[model samples]
Target: MGQIERLADLVVRAGVNVQPGQGVVVDSDTAHLEIARAVVEAAYRAGAGWVEVIFTDGPIQRSAVDHATVEELSASRPWALARIAEWRAAGVASIGLVGDPDPHLFDGADPARVAARRHDEVRARRDAMFAGMRWSLVAAPNPGWAKQIFGEPDVDRLWAAVSTAMRLDSADPVAEWQARTATLAARAKQLDALELTAVHYLGEGTDLAVGLPPNARWTGGGLIDHDGIPYLPNLPTEEVFTSPDRRRADGTIRVTRPMVIAGQLITGLRVTFKGGRITEVWADEGGDVIRAQIDADEGARFLGEVSLVDRDSRIAKAGIVFHNTLYDENAGCHVAWGQSFPWSVEGGLAMTPEQRVDLGLNQSGVHTDVVIGGDGITVTGTGPRGTVDIIRDDEWVL
Candidate 1:
């Protein structure tokens, strides 16, 4: 098999663990037809009963967002999410490919409308999966994504890096990944044992404190299918994570790196969170929109995820800051707001939305990841008892 085919097969079999007679769903753009086809073949090879593909085009969606009506924006599409939810509820498998064909397709569009038009149907699927199901999200590294990272638009180079990052070259990548996951899981367990009260940040123009919930548990790596089939969320991932105390985030967090959010590039973004609400936002570009979204959604103002990626990570070593989540999130320590994964909390999957809200667990349909760690950033942890240094200069500290 060729590199792309081999990688796709591995992702379906090892990363997602598609089961025989189970439904398989793939989400990709037309530009990724080849890879998407490979994924379909791989799912069938794994004995999937059926494979469904969703082709999403960036330009078309951008056109709709830029010109669609208010009714269209708020209109819910239950059918889309229903398919995935039913599949998962029936113990189906899912694999997704995220490779933006037009990184800046909606760069000039109204950010408010762009954010508002998202389908709530998809949110149900996300909720169901987080409630306990099987899924995996990988990237195709298409030319458009490459162009977003490298001005020359080097698709081949990006693919090569992605292949290496995903470990497609290894003779037994599944085994290799298992070993890596065990190692990282050990680190997460160690951190969890520490029972940290807070994560403190100190760096260039950045000083923030992110608190930890008493029930917070350190987590990393992949999840399992409904039938207990295991899978990885991001290929080449090397980070340990946990859900932060959503209501306890305080202080200022300066954006040390640029990020592409909702089809727009946001630079020099600095946000101040007081009592878990975004009180201020400052950015050289695309700041107002970021502020609007956080203000629009209920949990968008609270913290959802706290992650730590070491300098030795594959993405970090590659020296590429891919604007996409598949690569950017693996590049370094980052945090997410809006939606909190139910798997991150104990007995979370069984909790109702209202119960989750009472426990400070957010359930917004949106989940936007933004980088906040880099060179010279020190993260310290402090509770009522004492203080423990967690990260120094962007590296994990024990």
Candidate 2:
């Protein structure tokens, strides 16, 4: 097999753990057809009963999302999510490839229509595969993405970076990851034992207080369900994270790095949180969208996640910002302000939104991850006794 084919096989058989005879779903944009084809072949090699490819075209989505009618937004597709759920329930495997070349393709689009269509899709799959789903989110570096990250389209370099980050260069990446997971799990257990009060974040243009829920649990590495079925979420993950209390955070958080928000790249984005809700949002570019989002709805202003990254993060070390989630999110400590992942906690999806909210789970159809770390960043945790440093200079200080 060629390099891409081998990578796809590793992702399907090792990362997602495709079971024999189980159906497989490959989701990607048309720009990623090369990787998608490799995925199909890998799925078949893994003994998948059936393999389905869903190619999403960003330009087409941009047109509809930016110019579609209100009715069009209201009648947005629902069957797609339903089909995914059906496959999940049947123990099918799913591998998603996400990396946008133009992050801001929908920057000036109608936010209401976006939210409307978004809610419909979220509502559809709200209960899909609460358990028994083998899925992994991976990346396929395209020319567009390469151009975004490297100033010019250099796919070879991008692929090299991705492969290195994913440890595909290793002689036995699976075994390497096994050791890494144990280390991360041990760290999570240590942090969880502390029962932290709040995490203090500090950096240039940043000072934020991140509060933890009473039952907040630190999570790292691959996820294993109650049934002991392990699955990776992000193929090149190196962060430990937890869901945060959406109603108790306070202070200012400036986006230390550029991010692709709602399809447009937002730079110099900054926000002030009061009483756990974003009270002010500012950006050098794409500020209007941030304002629109903060004004979108009540839940939009609160936080959903707080993740920590080490200095060893591949994206950060590479010194290239891709402005894509599949890579950027792996670079540093970041947070999401909407739509908490049910998989973030034990029994996350089994509970309804209302039930989840009662347990302090932030629920929304939207999940926006924004980086908040920089060279001078320092993250300290406080508990009943005192404070302890967690990260400094974008490196883990603990």
Candidate 3:
């Protein structure tokens, strides 16, 4: 089978693990219809009860972001929200196929307005679905994205890189992923046994500390939903992650890879935290956009998650900066702002939002990750037993 078809099969059968008689939802941009169609076909072949495709248009979205009134921009279509709710209520599986066809679509737009206009209601609905449904995010390469990365529209090259990152090249991709997930699960168990009180990051331009709650637990790879269906949230995931105590982070850290945020490429991004709230931000480019996003809401300034990945990650080994968080964040250690996952701590989902905030779990409409691991980076975990090296020279030590 061709790579696209193979990827469709992987996403349907392994990524979201669409079971027989289950409904499936595929969300994609118009530019990605090829892969979206493949996913629909694969889902049906797997005996899916139904498959729905929601196609988005990038240029139209850009126009809306640039010209729409604040109220209009913030408003979400009731039907869209209702559709997701219905799917979630029915225990459906979802696949999000994302690849920005125009990475710089809003480069000259007003960053503050763009930040102010985020669809809060839509985000809440999506978060609710995330907490209950089986879902996966997969990439769909397009000429525009390829041109942004390589200075030329080489879709074939982009496809090859994406396929490799997704492990589509493996003789048995499903089995390979299963083995990889088992290994990551073992690593997560080791970190959990440490009972770490805090993690300290040391490297050039980075000397930061992130505290962990007593109930924090590390997890990676596949996750089992309420119905016992296992799913991979990201096609090329590598990091084992946990929510940090949002009230306890401090010090400064530098981003090692460029981040494409809201159609702007942010480079040389540096941030300082005091009492878990972002106090300062600097970047060689797109600092205004970063500031605007951090100021979006009350909890947007706090740390929501801290994830660790070593140099040996598949994405890191590939040595390509995809400029997509779903891929780049997996290449190294990364930290997120806003919206912590409830599954990161024991009984987290059951806790009320206020109760979770009391435990230092951050809450907000934004969840953005910035990669921060590379050569010379060292991560140490501190607990009752003293400090233990968790990562050294960009490699996982224990």
**lDDT for position 123 in model 1:** 75
lDDT of each: 0.77, 0.76, 0.87
In candidate 2, residue 5 scores what lDDT? 77
TM-score of each model, paired residue for residue: 0.94, 0.92, 0.97
| Candidate 2 segments exceeding 4 Å error | 74-78, 107-116, 294-297, 343-352
**Steric overlap count per candidate:** 0, 3, 0
Residue-by-residue lDDT tens digits, candidate 1, 48-124: 89989989887778778878865688687777666766876677666788867776777778777766745476577
RMSD of 2: 2.3
Ranking by TM-score: 3, 1, 2
TM-score of 1: 0.94
**Model 1 root mean square deviation, Cα atoms:** 1.9
- In terms of lDDT, the best-performing candidate is 3
Q: Which of the numbered candidates is closest to the native, going by highest TM-score?
A: 3
User: lDDT score, residue 94, model 3?
Assistant: 84
Candidate 3 wrongly placed segments (more than 4 Å): 116-118
